[model samples]
Target: MIHHAGLIAAFMDGGWRGALIQGPSGAGKSDLALRCLDSGFALVADDRVELWTSGGRLYGRAPETLAGRIEVRGIDVLPAPALAWARVSLCVRAGTPERIPEPAFTDDFGLRLPLLTLALLESSAPAKLSRALRHLGERR
Candidate 1:
């Protein structure tokens, strides 16, 4: 079976396989996830995603505990849109200082996936997330 690391934020509506947003705590991972959701992406799991391997493909599901709860800072915990099960296709690590240089690709268990490192900027995160996801889809 596919073994997953810690928490993962996956998208469900854009494609069959989703992107796993990973990073150290307080790196805005959840914030990015929220932005992605606002940009038409479904939340698979906010803080936990179950990973499994089948037929050489890796899939993920939302953990029951944090399934619908998405933290919105001052807004209190909110329920995200219903999630869709999906296979994980990409893993993005959060950058310190809120931003990182635009990355090209990153390695995951020896496999390479395109990178869209977060550069901490006050710009529209949702729009940026949408653009990045669209780019990712176009690449495949």
Candidate 2:
């Protein structure tokens, strides 16, 4: 079940679950995902993600094509631990801009997941993402 277009995964809550970031190519998804992982977020999947909707709810997974793989520019693809496929809460779609500024928005499949878009150039994007995740959890 191919998710859609472009996406990356991040494991949070002690690997209990994860969030998926859906965006287009060259949107700096991997770079942002990597930064988030470096700041303690685990990589569930990068590149291709497989999604499924059941019981009027949405679920997602990493396709076998790009499971356990994280790409780094000018470097090899880093392997990640096995993920038990979790539900997605938030989807972040950021671009390569100057600064993160404030949290942005991302919505898909009729579900509005307030995505926190940040410019990849900003070194603090991951930190902001982490904070956004925490805020999301608290709000939910």
Candidate 3:
């Protein structure tokens, strides 16, 4: 089991999959999620997500209490479309990463996943994430 300070968003083009978005509190985790949703991603978990490894792949799910809900910053909690689980294909760190090292990887529940970083507040972030997902899907 792995509890992380992040939210997970699942996107489906032909298959359902997800990315684990991690960062310090107020790092715009949920805000990034909202943008992703607008850009065609679905929520897997918000604020807190439960992660586990299954047959060598990492999966993410929302805790029961947080299911289908997301905090919109100063806005009230809102109901959103959500998936019970999804195989995590990547991990996204929301921040001004000092410097992006060469290909990065992060471990969760004993599984390693490709990691990427982005400035979540940027207007183009959601579009950037969507493109990254498309690129990843093509590679896999």
Better structure of 1 and 2 per TM-score: 2
lDDT of each: 0.59, 0.63, 0.78
Q: All candidates' TM-scores? A: 0.69, 0.74, 0.87
lDDT of 2 by residue, 47-81 (tens): 77777767654567677877778778668777865
Highest-lDDT candidate = 3
- Candidate 2: lDDT of 38? 63
The residue ranges of model 3 lying beyond 4 angstroms of the native Cα positions read: 10-13, 97-101, 137-140
RMSD of each predicted structure:
4.2, 3.5, 2.2
Per-residue CA lDDT of model 3 for 27-104, tens digit only, reads 888898988888778898888888777888888888899889988989888999898898888788886754545766
lDDT of 1 by residue, 20-133 (tens): 766666667677777666556777776666776666555677767766677786688787665556666666565542354554776554455666665423356556555565
Model 2 TM-score is 0.74
Model 2 pairs in collision: none
